[model samples]
Target: MKDFIFESTPKIVFGAGSIAYLVRELNILKKKSAFFICDPVIEKTIFFNDLSGKLKKEGFIVNIFSEIVPDPDFDSCDMARDAIVAAGSDIVIGIGGGSAMDIAKVAAITAKNRKKAKDLVKNPELCEPGMPLVLIPTTAGTGSEVTHIGIFSDNDEKLKTGIVSPYLYADVAILDPEITVSMPETVTAHSGTDAIIHALEALTSKLATPFTDLLAEEALGILYRNILPAFEDGNNIEARSNMLYGSMLAGKAFANSSVAAIHAFAYPIGAEFHIPHGLANSIMLIPVLKFNLNSDIEKYCRAARAIGVQTTGLSEAEILNRLLFKLEFLLDRLKIKRSLGYYGVTESDIPRLALSVMKVTRLLSNNPGEVLLEDAERLYREAM
Candidate 1:
C-alpha cells in the first residue's frame, strides 16, 4: 500500500436536533456578524427564518443572502460575496442544501480575500486565507458542510468548474436530521443514492487506503439500511439521522480517497442538463460501475457485499453481474429516471459532452482503470 496522509479539521455536530448548536457554535468561532446564505426555497421555509431569528437574538448581526440558485453558478457566488462584503460580515453561515453551502464557502473565501468571485473560481490559486465559516446543512448529500471542494458554473460561457482547497473547509459543520426531514421523497432518494456512489467510488479509488476504505464500507452499509426508510416515510427520524450520518462519513471517505468515474461523467450531465447533482450521479452509477468492473473485480465484490448483496459460491464475474442487477433494482425502486435524453440531451450532444468530460481529468485520473476519450463516450452513450 502507498503511504497516505489524512487530515480533517472541521468540528462536526450531528444528530436529530444539532442545529440548536448554531448560536453557541458561532460564538465559539468568534463570529460577531453572520451572513446566512441559502437558496430562495430554503430562505422562504420556516427553518431558515427561525434560525436567522435565533442568531440575531444571540447578538450576531444576521444578514440573509438568499439568492442562491441550483448547481450554483459564478453569478450566484458573485452576488453572495457582494452581499457578505457589503454587510461587513465577520462570519459566514450556510443553512440549506449542498449548492447553498458550497456557494457560501466560496463566498466567504472570496470576501475575506477581497477578490472577485470569478477570480477564485477561475484561478483557485488566488485564494487567500479566509474568515471563519459555520456550515449548517439542511440536506444529506454533497456534504459541502465538510468537503474541501466547491463546484460552480460560469453562466456566460455555460461551463462548470471546481475550486479545491483546504482553506475552504468550514470551521464547523452542523448536521441536523430534523432539518432534512422536509426533503421531498424524490430528493431523499436521489441524495441517498448519491451518498452511496460516494462510498462506492472511494472504495475503488486508485488512491484507496485502509482508513478510507473502512469509512466507506461503514457508510455504504448505513446508507443501504436506512435510505429507503427515510424516503418512504419522510418523518422517520431514525432513518433521517442514519442517512445524514452516512452521507457525512461518505463525504469524508471520498474527500480523502477521491470519487472517480461516476462523478467525472456526472459533471457534464449536470452542467449541460441542469439535473440535480445527486440525481445525475444516480443516473450514471450503474453504467460507470459496469465500466469499472474489469479494473478491480475483487473490490467490486467487496462493495457488493457491503451493500448486503451475497456473492458466496459465485465467481467474481458472476458477483459483478449480480451487483449490476442489484443496482438496477435500487434505481427502479427509487424511481430514478434512467436517460439523459429526458434532460434535453441528444445523441448529437455526445461529442460536446465527451469533450467536457475530458476537462474533469482531475477526477478521471483517479479511477482504477484508464478512461480514454472513446471509453468515456461509450459510457455516455450507454447512460443515454
Candidate 2:
C-alpha cells in the first residue's frame, strides 16, 4: 500500500428533508448574517424564496448574490467577494450547482484575504480561512461541496484554472435529494456522468491510496447503478439520494487522491467552447479511459467489476475491452453523444487544446501514466 493521509473536514447532513436542518446548522455555527450565493435562475424558484424567508425569520440578515453563471470566471468571483465584504457577512451559504458553490468558496477566501481569484490561483498558500461556509449542492455533480478545490475560467486566455487548498472545504455540507428531483433529464445525465468520471479518475490516479480506492469503488458502484434511474425518473427520490451520496463520496475520494488526465483535458474544451463542465467531461471520458487502459490494468479491471461488469474467468485484456464497451453503452444510454466535432472543434484546434491541457500540471501530474504533449493531442483527436 502506498503511504497516504486521509482527512475529511465537512460536517455532512444527508437525507430527505435534510434542508430542514439548515436553521439548526446555522444556529450551531452562530451565523447571524449570511451572504447567499447561487445562480440567478435559482432565485426564481419557490425553494429559494422559502429558504430565504425562513432565514430572515430566524433573524439572519441575508444578502443574496445571484449572478453566478456557467463556467464562472474570475470576474464573477470578484463580484461575489465584493458582495460578501459589503454585506458584512458572518457566513457564506452556497446553494445550486457546482458553479455556485465554486464561486462561493473562492469568494469566501478572497473576501478575507483581499486577493483576486487570479492571484489566489497563482498562490493558493496565501489563502487564509475565510468566513464560515455552508454548501448545499442542488445537483448531483462536481462534489465541490466536499472538496478543497474551486475551479473557474480565465476569460482572457480561454482556459480553466483552480484554487486548491484545504481552506476551501465547506464547514458544513447539506445533501438533500428533494432539491435535485426537479432537475431535467439532461442535467441529471450530465451531472451523473461527471461524478462517475470523478470516481474513475481518482481510482486510477497515481496518487490513489487504499482508502481512496475503497471510496472510489463504492462511489462508482452507486453512481453506475443509480445514474440511469435518476435520469429516467427525476422524481425517484431513492435514485436521486444515491446519486447525491455517490457524488459526495467521489468528491471526498478525489479531494485526497485527486483526479487526472480526464479532468485536465476536459478543462480546455469547456473553457473554449462554453460547454458545461459535466458535459465536457462526459465527452472526454472514454478517450481518456482508453489512454490510461494499460497504465494500471488491475485497477481498471477492479473498476470494471465495481461498475458491475462481470470479469469472472476473463483475461485482463478481455476485461478492459468489456469495460470500454460498457462505457460506450452507458454513454449512449444516457444520450451524451457529443464529440469534439459536435462542439465545432477541429484538428487545428487540437494543438491549442493540448497546450492548454498541459498547463494544468496540477491535475496532469496525478495521471497514472505519463501524458506527453503528443498524447494530449492524440487524445483530443480521438475524442473528436
- Model 2 Cα lDDT, one tens digit per residue, 281-345: 98888888888999999999999999998898999999999889988899899998768898889
The weakest ten consecutive residues by lDDT in model 1 span 153-162
The residue ranges of model 1 lying beyond 4 angstroms of the native Cα positions read none
Model 1 RMSD vs true structure: 1.5
Where does candidate 2 stray beyond 4 Å? Answer: none
Q: Write down the RMSD of all candidates, one decimal each.
A: 1.5, 1.0
| TM-score to true structure, per model | 0.96, 0.98
Task: Go through the candidates in order and give each one's C-alpha lDDT.
Answer: 0.85, 0.91
lDDT, residue 309, model 1: 82
Among these predicted structures, which one has the highest TM-score?
Answer: 2
Clashes of each: 0, 0
Superposed by TM-score, candidate 2 places the C-alpha of residue 194 at a distance from the truth, in angstroms, of 0.5
* Pairs that collide, model 2: none
